[model samples]
Target: MQSNHTEKMSSLGLSAWYGEKQALVNVSISMKANSVTAIIGPSGCGKSTYIRCLNRMHELVPKATVTGQVLLDKEDIYGPGVDPVMIRRRVGMVFQKPNPFPTMSIYDNVAAGLKLTGMRRGKSLDDIVKSSLEQAGLWDEVKYDLKKPGTSVSGGQQQRLCIARAIALQPEVILMDEPCSALDPVATAKIEGLMASLKEKYTVVVVTHNMQQASRVADFTAFLYLGKLIEYDETTKIFENPKEDLTERYITGKFG
Candidate 1:
């Protein structure tokens, strides 16, 4: 069962649609502050869509739209005059692929978000980029090569570079969609460790197919199936003793 801790983020009657096709039902689950919430299930289960909604990313799709309330500390993100760009500043996202700007240097990749948000050249920008890279566990490897093209880094380092780019803005929440899926085991391990450290400062919502990664990094786990939330509970309970059959079956290798 989920904890009784006051819901840090509340969702009420949330749903989404792509054109006329419904992608998610009336799903609602609250996440605690400064904790990692893992969304896991089979492919096409709407787990990625769900996390994208948290940061208003679903709206980026041409035919996609969402209904119902998603509250960040009880403030509706969909409310009037709320700039999606500004909201994204507060709620950052890392994609499944490491999509660093190919032509940009490592330093520039990390500085991209800050620059878009009106941060200018100076000591402050430098400090923020350096600190974010360090926080993402990429500084030691790339600090000497900051001027190199971002694409020149290995797949793993590039992924961490993307993470550093996300953190450079110092977002309050970080949404990751299968961040480690393309990485090797060692690289995936580094990102997992980064997620654990990140929760100490920011609320983290991750969508992953890897059940073990969820169990290791998440404080809470929400299982979704066929556009519906089947169960949400503490990580330990969900893996050790899930309340729902679907959750158990998926976790036990019955099927994705």
Candidate 2:
């Protein structure tokens, strides 16, 4: 069961399609403000597509289309007259791979986001970049090396750098799609640690295949299967005592 805390975002009858194939169906769940919500299930269960819809990124695909309501602060993001770019600004994303601008320097990579959003180069920009890097726990390691290429860092550092770029936007919500899928245990741990700290200011929704990671970081967990929501409850309840048989089976390694 979910508490009565404020919801930062919620979906109503949300569904998505790629050409003729339906990807999701009537999926509705509330993401609480300043909290971590983990979406877990087997591969191809619409985890990525569902989060993308939250930020209105699903429409970026060639044949993608979505229906229903994606409310941010109760405002319909996909409704008429709403701008998708603005929606992205309010909801930043970090993908599975640490894709920092391969050619840009670390400082430039973080600054790019601010500049694109019309924030100019100055003390303010510098402070935000530094603070975001610090917030992502990458400052000490790369502060002096700001001139180096973003890709010059280790896989873990690159991922954190990407996170810094996202946090630089100061988005209200952060959406991550299997952020640690490609990282080593140490790097994964660092990112996991970062997630816990981030919810202090932003709502976080992550899709992960690693059930243990979800159990460790998420306050609430939503289990999905075959494009349907099977169970959504506090993380402990989902793991320790899930109500749905499918959720229990998947969590216990009976099947993914």
Q: Judged by lDDT, which candidate is best?
A: 2
Residue-level lDDT of model 2, residues 197-228, one tens digit each, is 99988899999999999999999999989889
Tens digits of per-residue lDDT, candidate 1, 156-228, equal 9999999999999888889999999999999999999999998877888999999999999999999999889
RMSD of each: 2.8, 2.3
The lDDT, on a scale of 0 to 1, for candidate 2 is 0.93
lDDT of 2 at 25: 89
* Clash number by candidate, in order: 0, 0
Candidate 1 clashing pairs, residues 3+ apart or interchain: none
Kindly state the number of residue pairs that clash in model 2.
0
Compute the lDDT of residue 142 as modeled in candidate 2: 97
Off by over 4 Å in 1: 1-6, 120-123
For each candidate in the order shown, give its overall lDDT on alpha carbons: 0.90, 0.93
